[model samples]
Target: MNGDNRIHLVRDEIRRVSACDHATLDAVAELLGTREINVLAGRLGMVAAHMASRAGIAEGMPPPGTFPGAGNERIDLAAQWNAVTVAGWFVRKKLTAWWWHDVLFDGVLVTYELVKAFVTAVVDDDPSHITRLTLRLRALSAGRLVIEVHDSPENAHLISAADNLISPQVEHVAHHCGRHEHQGRTVLWCELARPELSRWI
Candidate 1:
């Protein structure tokens, strides 16, 4: 998909994760200007995989170190798995919010949900609630892909199994956001290197 469409799909996944029921889904789908259930589900799947990976990694179930094969197929499969995990976390939350259906807690829960989505999309590895995610960008040869994810003080105890996947020359920063107050809001950030935004001559 094109960047714009891919971005919309990402946003739709977020909305789908936020809704409570069929009617709510319909409303959100309408707001997003699409009725394709498969597309919505694709987005959701992506999210689920990430959330699952996050939880699993945190609990000691590790993600695969090597993707088995080389070339585009392997890359596509990784992307597919990543997308599904990322999407699943949100959908699971949607189901819960549907069950509880509380308005007062909606804002807080939903914000955490969004934060999860944001981190999953960019972290280049499993989601660990124990750590705050921040981002950094690095320069490499044109058309190359490099991603690195690490754990900080807040998440040091919960080791990520994806560290082995990191390529050389890809820099990462790990620091704890440790239950600290930031301008009246709790903050967690990961220093991520944005390879997608790199330029080549």
Candidate 2:
């Protein structure tokens, strides 16, 4: 992707994150009706009765390497729905997904924070060297979802930098949450369940 396009995504992501972190029902709902917001929401595996969209290649420029890459990349930016973001949407829309609110809320939040903290502590400015931070969410099943934040194949060894990050959060939840190796990618992951999560939430 060109530097201009990457910057645009980062700016948009910053805006979306701010919006999600401080969302109001009336303010966000009207925007939800738009084709753009609906498509963005749908990209993250969120679809209401009136809207259902699948995840696809973002913005068309597939970054760089085996994944998205750019040498002139200024900063990483992407709009992703964590459990907290998802729960917020569900609550605002009054959706019937109890599992989203009850299960993954703090679980994903903690994991997300832990991994980000690792990046900050280890990389200082971030391993991306001012690239976009993109998180991918996947539902392994009705009761489990995996959150992945990838740096780059070039910084593959940095994956082990998170080796010690999980214990702090694990002491609190400990529901199959940790770092994982899948194929060639390294990911920090957390799982959420309805009944099991009640003990923590």
Candidate 3:
């Protein structure tokens, strides 16, 4: 990606983060004036790396290796999600003035935060959640970024009630949506488009 593409991705991410953070669209508009896309993108990327490192340390996992090189980028989706997840937590508890009300009404943000907190707490307890966490990121982008995470049956009987719990919101994500179960793993995935941006792939 060129500088322009980077800027576009960063700006879109910032807008999305702003949304997930419960910043009113108006508040994001306010930010547009003072923040340059490149600077914000750099900060976003750094924030993600920092949070991912913290999550890894909390889990007692070894830190990831440095990037092979900048051009070798393959979309560190886990870290991206980590960044957004941590941001969601911060936005809800630290940044927003209406945290209490928004937590109830902002379903997308709520679910995202739930997944983050759940994943963080589980990773803190055991290492197994790392695999599921990686899988969740892949499933998120496999076809179109449509993805879901629920508790395993052993941990929580989530699969049986997934549809009733999430269908109303996720129905539009894919025509063929369902759960996939493995020995100790379960995931609900769908196809979702990356939100269109003016630049980059």
- Using lDDT as the measure, the top candidate is 2
In model 3, where do residues sit more than 4 Å from their true spots? 1-135, 139-143, 150-163, 195-201
lDDT tens digits by residue: candidate 1, 88-188: 34433543543322221332233233234334433444433323433211111121111222234443332332222221211122211112222333222
**On a 0 to 100 scale, what is the lDDT of residue 163 in model 2?**
56
| 1 versus 2: better TM-score goes to | 2
The lDDT of each candidate is 0.33, 0.43, 0.40
Per-residue CA lDDT of candidate 3, range 1-201, in tens?
799999999879756775665456457657675446566665566556433433332332223333122111111123223644543443344313422332222424434543554355445454453323332322121112223454544434333333333344444543334455555454544333333434341
Better of 1 and 3 by TM-score: 3
Error of 2 at 13 (Å): 48
Give candidate 2 regions above 4 Å deviation: 1-99, 125-128, 182-184, 196-201
TM-score each candidate: 0.24, 0.41, 0.28
Task: Show the lowest summed lDDT stretch of 10 residues, model 3.
Answer: 67-76
Q: Which candidate number has the best TM-score?
A: 2
- For candidate 2, the TM-score is 0.41
